[model samples]
Structures are given as structure tokens and as C-alpha cells.
Target: AVANVCGFIASTLHRGIGLIHFPTTLLAQCDASISHKQAVNAPHGKNLVGSYYAPIRIIVDTDVLQTLEDWLLPDGMGEIVKHALCQDVDLLTYLEEYDGALNDPVFLDYIVRRTIELKCEVIDIDPKENKEAVVLIYGHTLGHPIESISHRMGTACCLSHGQAVAIGCVIAARVAFLMGLAEESIIERTEQICAKYDLPYLIPADQSVDRIMSKLPFNKTWTKEGTMMALIERPGKVFNFDGHFKCPVDDATIRRAVEQTMAPFGTIIKGSGSSGALRKNKLSNGDLASSTITTPIGSPMEKPGEGWAVSAGGSCPKGDC
Candidate 1:
């Protein structure tokens, strides 16, 4: 939090070079390096106080991802899948076809570049996240709360930010389907892609619906009127009823979506271990069995020994080390 404040201040004070080195695939695919956003957590919710300050340049070192455990790969895939679902249909197809190649450095680099490119296009159009860029928050409405609550509950490793967002995407897709905005097939496909990537397609039974619902009002997306959500109409399209990209979704509808998404996973949650069938399925596929450590969300810098460490040389002036 202190570093975020300092970075924001630095960006405001001078035009210094801001270089970001993303170690994990999650950081590369998600907001860690690509976005202009800087945020700090508030007492009420996450990222309640934030500003827009684009980095001078962002660097993603795919070579560092070789050390990333298998469970951690899905953290990055959540954002990759989110971007593909919101903008690139071909990216989605690529992910579906090559889900098993997540550990491949070449493939990982390609997907990371694609995800960054998609976000860059959105940021180029709407740097402030008011219009076109707002769609980038596709699954984040529910995803954020799940992430924060899970972290507070000491279950951050079990439900990483990416895992939560993947499930959140499924929930948002279901809501879109129920609202007649998206097709049933899209929801199924979303679930299948999440499953293929070893992501959770349903809400975990341990996550309290009431607790999740209580956090909705405190979301950073909330306005004076209500909470704004990025609902989808299709895989490569966002639902825009009015001129705005974000639509004001009522609490009741949100609750319904949460309930519906969680309904099917009850048996799996109860029958299998706390890790759920998803972990079992991933294990069956010969993926790594080790659990993952917690990572910072949307923050570029991490504690030493947590993520990839900087080289012995000084800071990277350009994106290249």
C-alpha cells in the first residue's frame, strides 16, 4: 500500500520511467503491468481509493514463468480468458485448443502478448475506465469481493484472484444468459473453458453468499445510484443497452446469479475434498499437485522471495532488462 501511494505520487510529480517486470502469467495477462490504474484498499472495500497512472513501459519475462507452479498458472488464465471472452474470439479458440500447453513458455508468451494487446486497445480508447475500457472489468464485480473475503479468511491460496475471477466470469455469463442478453451456449462454453484451464466454474461452498452479497455495495464500481457491472452479450461482445458500457445491475439480479452459479457445485463441494473436483480433474490430467502461494493483486512489486527477483544489475530503464 505504501508503495502504491509512492508510485502514484511519483507519477503525479514527474514523468519518470516506470518499468514493470511481470513474473507470473497471471500478472502478465491481468492488470499488474498493462493498465494505468493504481489503487489502495479502503476499510469498506478493495481499490476504493485509486488513480490512473500508466506506466511508461511494461515488461513481461516469460522465462521466469518456468518456475511457476501449475496451480498458479490458472491465476493468469482467468484474466486471459476474461480478455478473450470480452474482445478476441480467436484468442478464446486458441485458449480452448491449447489449454494443456499452459506451461509452455512459447505459448504462454503468445497468450500474454495477446492479453496485453487487447487491454492496450481498450486503454488506448478509454484510459480512465469510463467507457470502452470499463468492459475490462467483465468478471471483476463479483471477483473482487470473492478475492478480498477469501484473503481475509486465510484461504487465499485455495481461491486465488484468478480462480475467483474465472468463477466470477461464469456467474456473469449466467446472469447475461438469464437476462436474455447472451445465449445458453456461451455460458456452457465459458464453464468448459474454465474447466479446461483448471479454474473454478462455480462458487465454492465455503464462500458465504450473504458475506459476498454484503460486500457488493462497497465495490469500487458502485456509484451514487447503484453498482455498475459489465455484463456480456456474447463471447466477443459486451451488452450495452444504453450508451454506457457499464449497466446498473440490481442487487436482486446479482443475488440470483450468485445462487444459480453456486447451486450445481454443492454436491461436488460436499462429496469431494475442500479443493473440489476441479483440482481432482487437474490432477488427473497430469498437472502439478503442489499448492500455490498467495500473490498480490494488481500490484506490480512483490516482497522479496515471493515472486521473481530482480537481476543483480540496477533497475530496468527500458522494458528490457
Candidate 2:
């Protein structure tokens, strides 16, 4: 948080160059690298304080990802899946056909480049995340809450941001299906892709449905009138119910979607126990203990000044940089 704030301040003060080295795939493909956004988490919500600050240039080193543990690979795939669903059908096909070769540097480079390009296109259209750019947040409406709550409960290692977004994709697909916007195949494909990457599609048994639902209002995507979510009708196509790209989704629909998404994994009985399919291959406590969180470096902003400042090396004061 301090690094990003420092970077944001430096960019505002001078013409800075932001060099981001993505150790995890998620940081490479998602908000950390390409977008003109900087933010820090607050007590109320994630990314509660932020501003639009695009970088002069972004450098993605695929070799850096080679050092990531196997479990960490899915974090990047979550964003890849999001891009494929919203903008690139070919990318979706690639994921389905080459699920086994996900770790290959060549394949990883291609995915990262393509994902970055897709994001760049969106940023060009809506640099401030106001209109068309909102589509980029296809699965994040629910994904953010799951991530926030998981981190708060100290289960973030068990449920990483990428994993939560993967689950969010499934839930969004289900919601689209329920609204008669998306075909049944889309939902199946969404779940299949998540499973292919060993990412979570169902909400965990421990998370509270009510709590997740309550966080909807606080989402950054919401407007003054109502909650706006980016729902999809098919791969590479976003659903636009009323001509506005950001569609308004009701609480009842979101609740139903959450319930149905959780139903397949298990039935949440009152206060006692869940009955149904037991969670298989759950992450061991040791694995969770060893898990680490990586925050993306903020992009630099173009301000008139003399020199450039880079925030690299040394420990972050907040211990979360």
C-alpha cells in the first residue's frame, strides 16, 4: 500500500517510469501492470482509495513466472479466463485445448501478451473505468467480496484472489443463465475452464452467503441509482440489457445465483453442517501457511517534471508492499 501510494505521488510530481516485475501470473494479466489505476485497501473495502495513473511503459518478464509454485499459476489464469470470456473467443479456445501446457513459458508469454493487449484496448476506450471499460470487471463484482472476506478471515492462502475470481466467473455465468441472457453451455464452459486450471468454481463452505451479499453495495462498480454488473451472454460478448454497458442486477438474482453456485458443492444447512459432495483435494494447512500475497505495482502517471523515480528493493513499511 505504501509503495503504490509513493509511486502514485512520484508520478504526480514528475514523469516517472514504472517497471513492474510480475512474479505471479495474476499481477501480469490483471490490474497491476497495464491499467491506469492505483489503489490501497481500507478498513471499509478493498481499493477504497485510488486514482487513474497510466504507466509510460510496462515490461512483463515471462521468465520470472517460471519461479512460481504450481499453485500460484492459477492466479494468472483467472484473469486470462476473464479476458477470454469478455473479449477473445480464440483465447478461450486456447485455454480449453492447451490446458496441460499452461506452465510452458511460450504459452505463458502468449497468454500474458494477449491478455495485456486486450486490457490495453479497453483502457484506450475508457481510461477512467467509467463506461466501456467497466466490461473489464466481468467477474469482479462478486470476486472482490470473496477475496476481501477470505483475506480478513486469514484464509487468503486457501482462497487466493485468482481463485476467488475464477469462482466469481462461474457465479456470473450462472447469473447470466438465470437471467435468460446466457446459454447453459456458457456456464458449463466457465466451470470447465476453472476446473481445468484447478481453480475454484464453487463458493467455499465456510464463507457466509449473507455476508458476501451484503458487500455488494460497497462495490466500486455501483452507480448512484443501483448496482451495475458486467454480465455476459456468451464468450467474447458482454450482455447489455438497456443499451448501457453496465447492467443493473437485482439482489434477488444475485442471491439466487450464489445459492445455485454453492448448491452443487454442498447444501448449507442452518447452523450445523453441510451435506453433499465433500470438498476434495482441499489445500493443506501447511500449504496455506506457506502461501504469500503479491500486490501489483502501480502504473506511472505522466506529469511534467525533470527525472523519474522507481520504487524497488527494500521492505515495504506496511509489510504488504
Candidate 3:
């Protein structure tokens, strides 16, 4: 889908036409939003038609999520899970433990800000995929098939993109373990976290491996060698390539593994019973997390390592970092 869009935009520009990308899916915000990748499906595989064309501007407005289906939330979460798997334990913990707080403005603000910071960091490090910045695809090699199948089948009984990706994460984790890139614990942790958010760890039932494989060649990441799957070994460490195993299984193994990791719920994290009590104990301001780690309510810029770290070891004040 992304590759095709890019091709259309590029081809049109060559012939004197204009193209604009407005991504409503959750995956769009995290990965697809970063660059120009358009794709379309064909008999051989998923994205058969595509090209790269940078957009004039990429706009992300949280308000758009308001009208989206509840299932779509997890679709976006695939990207979030990928980001968390890469650089932020805080994010993983938050999603696994305090995801209920997401409804709170304060919590959402922190998440939004953190996401922006992470994206900026990645773009800064590698505006072009000339380096390891490509690690962003940690769970995507498997994820693309899930999404392609879901999209190809349409919305009726198919998994949404985010759900497919969530399941893909599980598949990647298992693959990681098989290749010795990641430990069993990480796979369990990934599954546990997804469960906390009500995301399915297993692939959708009845999904055919051959069906998904049929779409693989068209994927943007596909190469002359074969499909490449990115597996997470540890936070910030990703391993990618095509044929790493001595005894690689067929598509059936892939389908079965995906199913084994499926979760019963969808993706929105549920509030624990204490959620009401926490809301009831609201502070005067919206700095709930910050309020927990304070020191003497000290004056602004008190000293180094203090709430307000001022130079010269003098109190600078509290308002600043």
C-alpha cells in the first residue's frame, strides 16, 4: 500500500501532477510517516507497484484517532511497540503497567512528547537509511504479511493492521529466540506487555502462510535474496537478514507460530481496579509522575543534579530542568 502510493505520486510528478499522502492508519504515524514508501498488491506478492517521493509535509493530529475504530488503536500500537522495543524502557513499562492512564491528558502528553523526541532522534541519526537506523524494522519483516493479508481481505473478518503487527511482534520474538538473537524471556515479556494492552500475540486463525508468502515479494524490504525479517535481541539491538537458520521451516511453521502467540483481547490497555482511585487522588496540577520524584520543593536552580541544576553549583531555580 505505501509503495504504490509513492509510485503514483512519483509517476504523476514526472507527468506534471501533484500528490499528497494522508495516512489515517496507526502504522502511518510511526513508520510509514517517516518517509515516502508507496506500495500496491499483485499476484506475486503484496507491494508490486511503488516508488519513493518525499511528501511536502507530514501532519499528525491526535484528534484524528477520535473517529477511528477501537481496533485501529492496536494497529498504531505495532509501531509503538517497535519504538519501545528499541529505545525506551519507560514506554514498555508504561504500556505494560500503566496503560490505563493513557486516557489521562497528563499521561497522553508525556507519551506524545516522548514519541516526538524518539522520531527526531532517529531522523537526526540517519535521515537516509545509509546506516543501522534501519533497525526501526525490528518486528516488520513478519509484520508486513499480517498487514497485507488483513488489508487484502478487507475489514470484515480480517485483523486490522495494528493487530496484525502486534501478532507479528510475537512472531518476530519467537524467530529471535530460534536464531539466538533474543532470549525466551524477552519473547515472554513482549507477549506479556501486549496482553496487558489487550493485544493479541498470536496470528489470526485460518490465515494461510502461502497467502501471506504470496504477498512478500512486493514488500518494500524484499530483495533478490528473499524476505528479510528484523528480530529484536535487546532494547536498541536488532538483527536482520534473509536465511539465518540451518533448517528453515516452511510457511506452515510461520502460520502455526503466529497462531500460538495470539492474544484473546484487542489492544487498548485496560484500567486496573485502582484506576478510579488514582483519578480520584488527582493532584493540583497535572504533573502526577513528576510529583512522585521531588526533592525539598527546592528553589529554582539550586545546584548541580538538583531539580534546577544551575551552573557554578549555585541554585538556579526550580522552574527549569
TM-score of each: 0.76, 0.76, 0.64
Q: What's the C-alpha lDDT at position 36 in model 3?
A: 46
Q: Could you arrange the candidates by lDDT from highest to lowest?
A: 1, 2, 3
Worst 10 residues of 1 by lDDT: 302-311
Task: Tell me the lDDT of model 1 at 120.
Answer: 87
Candidate 2 wrong stretches, greater than 4 Å: 1-26, 154-157, 223-225, 263-321
* lDDT (Cα atoms) of all candidates against the true structure: 0.68, 0.66, 0.54
Measured by TM-score, how close is model 1 to the native structure? 0.76
What TM-score does candidate 3 get on C-alpha atoms?
0.64
lDDT of 2 by residue, 1-321 (tens): 333564466456655555343334445445466667767767656677766776665556788788877766776688888889988899999888984566788888888888888888878989987777877788889988866765542221235667778878888898888889889899899989988887777775445567677788788776656568888888999886666678877888887888677622232212100101111122233333223322223432232111112233422222121
lDDT of 1 by residue, 1-321 (tens): 334554466566666446353434555445566767767777566678767776665556778788866666777788889989989889999888873567887887788778878988989989988899987899989988766665441121346667778888998897787777888999899999988887887775445566777888787687666678898888888888689888787777787888777633222322111343454555568564223322222333322111121222323211111
Q: Candidate 3 on 23-82: residue-level lDDT in tens? A: 554556555665544555564444456554556666766556556655555556766776
Error of 2 at 206 (Å): 0.6
- State the local distance difference test value for candidate 1: 0.68
**Index of the highest-lDDT prediction:** 1
Residue pairs with backbone atoms closer than 3 Å in model 1 (clashes): 26-76
